[model samples]
Target chain A: MEQHLVDCDLCFDALQVLQQQQYREKYQPLSASMQQYIRNSIKQVSHAHKAERYQRQEQKKESFLIYFWVVAAIAAGAGLIYLIQQQDKFKPSVTKAMASNAEIPAQRVEAPAVQAAVVTPVRAERADTLSHRPAPPAATTTAPVAPPAATPAPATPKPVIKDSVKAKTPAAVPVNKDSAKKQAPPATKPAEVKETVKAPAPEHKDTPTVAKKTEDKPEPKPVPKEKKDDDDDKPKPKPATETAASGTDEFLYKAAMVYHQQGDLNEAISRYKHLSGSSGKYGELSRYQLAVCYRSKGQTGKARRMFKEVVRMNGSMKDKAQAALDNL
Target chain B: MLQQLSNLSDKELISRARKLKDQEAEGVLMERYSHLMVAVCLPYLNNGPATSPEEIYPALLQRLSDSLKTQTIPKANEWIHYTIRAQQARTDKNSPFFPSTESREQQQIEARIEKAATNQKEQQQLIATIERTLDKLSAEEKYLLKEFYMNNKSFAALAETKQISIEKLRQTLQQAKQKMASLLMNETYE
Candidate 1:
């Protein structure tokens, strides 16, 4: 630049003028204001960029909040579904427990009917054979056979069972059946008579076969046996008729049948079970009806056992009990 | 703050303007060269509406300020001088200032000299390379370089000794300096 300045007269002249320090003063204030102008522009640009960045951050925050709410709602809905499903699991079990409670009491009542069906038929036969005894033969001529047979509690059902089993020859089974049919009261409802009319087959078969058995026995045993035979034949024909015609057990049984007809099976079962302990035409009938109550209550096992006991008694009800057992 | 800014080098001021976007640093840089701009522009002032002092000086400073962000300005004087001349011609308002190849080469050598200043071995090597390149120039360039740089003679005194117009002499000297800078730049690349 020092070498070039010698040849450039115009630049040399401009330099000489600037050496005076007068033109330097002229440009200074204009320079100051231009610098101020550029600084103002920088401030404006920086402020604008800062505002844009802040707006972007706020937009990001709002988007994140929206996502959070959507996830929260989905979680809450899932929780509600799970809660409902959990409750559904317990609901059916509660219903099943209530059903089981109802069935347990039903089973308890059926159990007693089953017991009475097993115990009472033999006792009723015992009571009928013993209660019809004439007072004198019951003491003397019939003492050998009647002493054991007439004992109230211990020996009575055994003798009655032995007599009933030994008495029903195949020949007499039909005869007793006919007697049971003839003896059903005309005043009774057909349903009660259906069981009662069938009641006397084993009773009649036992007496007639017993009389024949006494007649056929050895001479020494036959003498005492014929006395019992006379006592059983003479009074049993009349007293048995009297007992069958108007027995307390018969009326009680009619009441139980009414309850059975009314669809109050529990009451009917309790009544039948009560009469089931006595002996007469009605005792056998109550045992048969108790089995019907057990069947109605859906206690088929107990019903089957009760029917088997009635069949074991070999009564007129044996055919009906066998048919019921086959149905079960 | 302005006093502190005034004490910083031109490189620091340019960095503050471009990197830090410090408008005040830019203002200080423009102000530093304002007097030379006023002097250089004085001849063309009031020659036309486009050349008025009220219009040209501010427009010239603004043009330099705009170019400062994008341009590689190693030497502020050469860049500013080229721009002032470009603005004075008034042919293209939107045309940006660019440093010439010769100016860039000269700026590279200046940078190399500054880098080697603290290293005695590099400074000596640089001085030897400059001397060897000066020995390669034509007699007149060598003579003018010696007379102007060595003797510290003014441009007018050198033009008088050579018995030529100062304009032609200035052009020859400019070409000689350009040749030296290119040779130095090529030597560095090798």
Candidate 2:
């Protein structure tokens, strides 16, 4: 029939007209009532779907909040546990200090005897040196008097004694004595009193052991001043060695960092200053922290100066120091 | 809700209908394609006799409701093909061109050729012959011819329903037309 329509012009024209008429009839829009019915049905379906979607979203939100609260509670519980553990670790040292304080008086009585035993050999050597001199007993008698006088005198003599003793004695003994004097002032004072009996030995015999004993006597007399000088001299090259040996500098540095993190600027500043004065591993870091402390405390001039010094050193703190300087 | 439904596309409305069984989404889908449904019904209704709009409209609606219930309708263009096929099948069953008494073995021979007559008589016979030839086609083939030649639906829509490319749909359409031509010439399509 298609071939027949293509061969015959009249049949082709009739088919085209029929098809066009069919197209026109088919394209006619539906009646208004049918359209209204469809619109109403669509409105119902859309409402149902929307309600279902909204319910699902609400359920999801509720589940998310529940999980968030659960996670937050777990994190808070872990933090509390950690804090408790830290407190337990630190409490024993405080209890030990309190226990030691309670036993101090008993220790004081026995302390003098221990000092006598420790000082006897040095004193006997001094006595032997006095046997060689004519006026050595006079020197021994004057030694106790000299100490009382020196106790009232200025800090200048402490350095002279330290330098002479350090020059004459074995290097290790003076360092040990200096550290001992630094560590326990009360115990060292009685020990120094016993050693004062041996102070005349160095003058008589010129022996290094007696010299060291003589140095130990005057050490407690000008304790505060001698400590300052010893701190200044000991930290220069031996700060790393000393901190490595004892771990006190590292502990103090950690404490300082904790204070800084805790926003205790004043305490952090004090700790950083002490650590900065020492040439330990933390020295450069402490200097940087000290600058940060000063800057936080609103002492911009001191902060800037410290930052400049750190920048000049060009150590680990150089970049931070440069940034701090720029911020200032 | 109606405003929201109005904002959604035809594909979205159908998806909602399928997934959520949303009555409003089905209603929206019906509204979107009702014109095409009415158009496809007109060809079947107007082909033989002058059927009343009242009679045709209810029957069309009934067929659409049945198809929607079955959920067998494809996309808009392909869906129109299904509706046309359904209309043609109903029309043929109600008014068959060939009598059921004619055995398949007897009908296998070519249809009798009529003598050439007056121009009006010849045109009427051509129309009858075309209708007879269309009835010989399977429902699927009738739907393809109606959508392709009559409605001129986009090849893209046909391809999507067929799950093939537009070029493939065009090639298939060409082959279908050749087979249709052979059937019209009283030759076996196979």
Candidate 3:
């Protein structure tokens, strides 16, 4: 049989076919349950991919909302800082107007009759002071009024000198008439009258006598005493006039600022307009404030006009006025 | 629709599965390849009357599913073949029948027979001829073929059971194969 297989191709082929038949019988069909398991697994994998895609989209939407809120918070914080800086810019102008009002009583003494005569001259001087040396005049006036109690002490002797002046010139009598009315009861006391009559009467007659007494006094004491006398005798009437004018200007500016701060642009605009017309130290500042009020009120044309006038003046407010004009 | 899909080949079914996410296409692929996969896995199974298809089928499906995910249709078929070959090698290593020279010779013969048969009708005819020849053999010849070839028993152990020398057992197997070959030739002529 071995020799036949070696010699014949048909015998070899038949043996090979029989072996393949034995091997092919090993393959068996799968049961129904196994196929069902495979289908279920594929469905699970597909569902997982879809769920992951949905989660990714949700995360994207959430991140967008987070970024939007963060940006909105930053904008709100910036707006608050800008409002605070704007208020800070308005503060110094209000303070400057207040300081100028405080300096008024020392510079000018007001007698009602003299006030009508003195106000125009004081305004001219104040304008000149603002243009060249805004600080020095206020400093000079404040230095003299440093001791108000000392001023009254020095004023006691002035009526005596004025009484002698009345005796020398009948023209001086009407000027002392109000002083006499206030002093008549004191004048009836003989020792007080004698002391006053003795000290100042000779000084009035002889200029040398008054000069010797002023020189013999310690220098510092006499300087302020003379200043106090001058302030009491003549400048007293002018201070009242100065206070009335400066007080009104300060009040108007302060009220405008208050109204502006409170967002009442109309009332602030009216008060700032009145100050802008006045020839006072606050005129330039008030014009700038008026422009701000007009701008706030959305009256852009009026704001532009006021800012233009302030820019042309070459005043301390010119830079701010120019900035305002540029904004418009 | 399912009948049309079933008519398609494994490569065509895989393409439909990828393009349409068609469950039917995937089902058809599973059905078509399931028998081949089970045959590949059979040598790995423990020798018993009751072999668990449950354990083997899911593992086979899982490997095929993983291959489907990363591969295009053309490459997926190659991947399935490679995976089955690799699994067969691993199972072959631990098989009690490994190193059986007779089993190796039988496998070679089986490959040649399958190549020559070509179609189901010829293969079925060969199977019938083998069954007829196996029935005509002596009881001892049938027992030797069943134990050594089908059951993958070591020849030395088979020889020991038969109370024969190893040389005599080889002579008996050679004579049984020549008898089967002669019977097949006679049937072909008839």
Candidate 4:
């Protein structure tokens, strides 16, 4: 019928006549309603499929986020555990090394040793040297010039100048000539004693402290001057090595200072290095000046190390070294 | 989406409906055959308690829908006609729809004809094969086919010329076409 209808005008005309019949009107609306109903059913099925797909995608995303957080938490917990273990490993070394020096919590042997440890290495060494030195026979005589400290040989470490048992040199000397007359015979010391006393005064900034002492103790002049004479006589009574060590330390310090002033950093660094081992004022001073020279020469790493050493030395330049280190 | 689905052939729509469980493709296929179904069932409407147009059409649609899911339908017209006739007789038989070999052959030949429309050489080849197939048929079948196709005679006109009913004429024309398709396919396979 289709093959015939394609070439036949009569069949096409008959199809049009059949389409014009009332049966089309009867089924057309029904067919349209059926199509709409079917479309609605299809839309419902498609919507359900889309909802299922969306729900699956959301579940996958949620699971992925859960995995990510779990991994992150595991990494963080592992890192924290490592840090704690590292801290635990270091704790015993600290407690053992500081055991004798610092007081143990259970038995705090004494805190004076801890204080001695905490004190600057220079001041602590000075205190040890002073305490180890023999008590001069003129200690009681020098009481008027001495500070008010009364501690024994193994005393708790004080500051750099806790010399109550020793005499104040400048305080004992009269600054003007007239007051110098009344104390002449008693204050007269050997030329060697006087020269030894006066030889090391102008090295660094310690000379001003001497003048400050005289100004501070102008009233107790006569007794302290006798005490000063006793202190001068101490050099002659000392071992030869003591004076010789002091002389070398002073000479090395002066040579370093000369090179330092002349901008010869390499030579100065070498000289300072030599002097820095000797535990005295020059040792502390050389270390501090070495750090300063390093800073000037732009060897920042070496400079930082030297400054840290000075700060650890707890010398007069500790504050300056700490500030420079903080800036660096 | 409906416009694009409407553009698909009956075979494509059947494939989508069966494999993808696409209701819209099924709907397009049903709507494509709705007029034919209505025309076939028009005489049987209100003939019995179950034969109302509304009842018969819905029931026919339901049977076609159920069969569409499970059956391999090569020819939708034959499947829909079987479903409509089954509904009209109130047979209550649950037999699944299957395409006859003749229908499959006819469908194959129709597909080949459609494919060859673009290539003139292939189109001439197909035409020659069909003519050769036509010449090999019995005289009565061959005469019915030539009158219906080459003469462009309507089924009513041919039935009137033979002094037979239009239904018988249509049946004879159907048999002749099937014979031609079977002959063409048998030759192709050989």
- Using TM-score as the measure, which candidate wins? 4
The CAPRI quality class of candidate 3 comes to incorrect
Give the range of the ten consecutive residues with the poorest summed lDDT in model 2 chain A.
A200-209
Off by over 4 Å in 2: A1-30, A45-66, A69-328, B1-9, B19-23, B35-74, B80-190
2 or 4: which has the higher lDDT? Answer: 4
lDDT of 3 by residue, A221-275 (tens): 3442355343233334323354465665666687678778889787677667656
Candidate 3 residue-wise lDDT, B42-153, digit = tens? 5555545334566656765766665565564433333455566555454534222122333334435456477767787877777877888899999999998778777877
Q: A8 in model 1: Cα distance from truth in Å?
A: 12
Residue-wise C-alpha lDDT for candidate 2, range A1-328, written one tens digit per residue = 4433322232333334345764564344444556765665456445667789889999999999999999999999999999999887555433432333343344445545544654444433333232224334544554555776666443533343344344433543454354344442332332454334333322222222232332323343244234533222232223224334235556567777777888989878877775664443476788889899999889999899889877766788899899989989
Q: If the candidates were sorted by their TM-score against the true structure, best first, what order would they fall in? A: 4, 1, 2, 3
lDDT tens string, model 2, B24-94? 76776667665555554554555555455556655655555555555533344445444555565655442
Ranking by DockQ: 1, 2, 4, 3
Report residue A280 deviation for candidate 3 (angstroms).
25
Tens-place lDDT per residue, model 1, A153-178, is: 44654454455445532323344334
Per-candidate TM-score, chain A? 0.28, 0.36, 0.29, 0.28
Q: What does candidate 4's lDDT look like per residue over B1-190, in tens digits?
A: 6778899999999999999778878888887876556555555667778776657777778888999998877767667766766666677778777777887887798899999999999999998888898889989888988998888888778888899976567667777888888899999999
What RMSD, rounded to one decimal, does every model reach? 24.4, 24.2, 26.3, 22.3
Better of 3 and 4 by DockQ: 4
